[model samples]
Target: MIDKFVPSVATALAGVKDGATILVGGFGAVGQPDLLIEGLIEQGAGDLTVVANNAGYGRVGLARLLAAGRVRRLVCSYPRIPGSVIFEDLYRAGRLELELVPQGTLAERLRAAGAGIPAFFTPTGAGTRLVDGKETRRIGTRDYVLEHALHGDVALIEAWQADRWGNLTYRGSSRNFNPVMATAAELTIAQVYHAAPLGALDPEAIVTPGIYVDRIVHHPAGALHA
Candidate 1:
């Protein structure tokens, strides 16, 4: 069990290298893994490519990474925020790189990676500015553009409860991105407010199976407010 539960975030991220793509699981501030994010900031991991639902909520989410200049590229839905430091500003100022993908399509890409399907066709962004230079193939009578699956070197996930075996349970909105991201990366690092032994979590309550997780880190402080 000691091998499965890493005490510190730095050790959990020891194998992660610079310029690696990373999938960050969160819907907003609610499910954002603040502890792990703070650890990454202190770790000084730079030139990162982040895949998440949003840039961040105020300063707790991706914004913290941005402030630290650790992230170089971002693949997300929303680009700008009113009076907030966003990924676009960093990109526009030649400090960051960005690829804005449609939210649904982005989720599908990660799912495809976890499912081991290399590339799939979708009509999500057809005949629009998004399809400007992409390859288009026709299936039967309809046109579908191919989007490749997205996989990352590391996936950062947050959970409401996690067992020592790495089984994870997310509460409410936090559940949105944790389960999918668990399978979307080569190494999954989870942050939980409550960490217990292997059998402590009810089977039905587990959102992410332990098999998909590689490390579990507990914050103990419980959920954090934005």
Candidate 2:
């Protein structure tokens, strides 16, 4: 049998090690997997590198994880949005390391990783400080920089629905970074609002197929407001 359901968030995150790279899915808090993050905090694997769209909001989700001192580095596009106090304090005090990537570039990098492409060129940060120490090439008067694919040891996802086979679906913008992060990680753990019967979901509505997801934890309140 190929059942991927896990009983709890802690079980979903089992085997994650210290010094692991975790891909955190969210566009601000929309698709952020807060319950799994809380479980990760309780699981206590430190010295992590977290990749996300932004630092975090208020003192919840990713922000709380950083404050817990589990994260050694953060790779994000927006390190400073409103209520990202925890990341700011840790960064300013040199307790945290940061790698700022352009939002579009970050998404592409993860996509490329999942697609099995080692590297790609894009014009997003071609002539800026973001491209420093990187290779640049000009094609038809437009300059592009080479970006390496980003792979994760684990990806924490938030889904609207999932099946025992691990197929997943998301609602609205909550789908934002979840799919790409799912495909790019070695072990993908999803916190879903519902665990539907194997054939309950419409085929066309399935946004993330079962092959990319490894574990699913049915959390009824996971995305109530997202």
Candidate 3:
């Protein structure tokens, strides 16, 4: 078996380069990989396109990345949050780009990428600006817009526990986007609160299988907000 564990966050994210598309798994701060975000901030690679559920709220997680001016574009469902002043200012000034996707569509796009399906049709954005210039097909009585799959160069995700083989188990709402994002990236790195020995995790409890994950970094206890 391949040992997917990495010594540190920096090591886990070592090869990340500028202008790379990154998938950040989180719903606000719930499933955000804090330590990995910190490492990326320290890595200082700029001009990033980030995909997530929402723009981060405060000075944590994706917020920190945005504040550092490393992100060039944001591809997410909800870009506005209570304290997302950084994103608001940059966006208003045209310094940042935004691709607003509907929540369910975003999830399905990532899932489609992981499943190797290039594009899929959905009625979610038919007849709206979201479907502008995109192909639309009439199915039954409704029109469906073609939405392309979303894939990333790197995926930073957080999990409750992981085995040495990189099998992951999430806690509560933290499971939101982490699992799907794991499968949709070229390099998937997971930050976990606990690291169990191989085979310690129950097979049925694994939300993300080790095959999709490339690396695992054990985050310090209490790093996650719970």
Candidate 4:
């Protein structure tokens, strides 16, 4: 088996390039990969497009990347949070581009990309501004909007535990987006609290199969800033 572990966060994210599209796994910092984001900040690769559930809040995690002005565009369900002033400021100034999708729609798009589906139609945003300029069709009696699949150059995810082969197990609500995002990217990196032996983790308990994960970094205790 190929060893997927990397010595440090920087090395795990070493291949990320400028102008790359990144799928970030998180829901309000719960599942955010803080160390990976930190490495990205230090890497200083600019003009990135980030896809997540929300813009980073406070001064940590994704917020640090946004504050550094590294992200050129943001695709997410919620861009504004109580303390996301950096994102708001940049967006209002037109320095950052924003694509706001409905929460369910966003999840489906990512899932579709991983499933090899190029696009899918849904009634979620049929009559709203979300469908503006997009193709629309009637199915049965309801109108549905066509949303294209979303894929990324890299995926950053956080998990509670991982085996040597990269099989991942998430803790509680922190599992949000991580599993799906793992399959939607060309390269998938995971930050885990613990690293187990090849067969230590129960096969039935693994949330994300190792085949979808490319790299794993063990996160330091209390590493999360928010």
For all candidates in order, the CA lDDT equals 0.81, 0.93, 0.92, 0.91
At residue 109, candidate 3 shows an lDDT of 98
- lDDT tens readout by residue for model 3, 1-226: 5788888788999999999999999898898988899899998899999999998987788888998999999999989989988789889999889999999999999999999999999999899997689999999999999999999999999998998888999999999999999999999999998889888999989999999999999886865422
- TM-score of candidate 1 versus the correct structure, residues matched by position: 0.91
The full ranking of all candidates by lDDT, starting with the best, is 2, 3, 4, 1
lDDT of 1 at 194: 81
- Clashes in each model (backbone N, CA, C under 3 Å)? 0, 0, 0, 0
What's the true lDDT of residue 147 in model 1?
A: 93
Cα lDDT of model 4 by residue, 97-179, tens digit? 99999999999999998999999989998888878999999999999898999999999999999987899998999999999
Residue 193 miss distance in model 2 (angstroms): 0.3
Alpha-carbon shift of residue 126 in model 3 (angstroms): 0.9
Q: 1 or 4, which is superior by TM-score?
A: 4
What is residue 189's positional error in candidate 2, in angstroms?
Answer: 0.3
Residue 80 Cα positional deviation in candidate 2, in Å, after optimal superposition: 0.6
* Highest lDDT model number: 2
Error of 3 at 8 (Å): 0.8
Lowest summed-lDDT stretch of 10 residues in model 2? 217-226
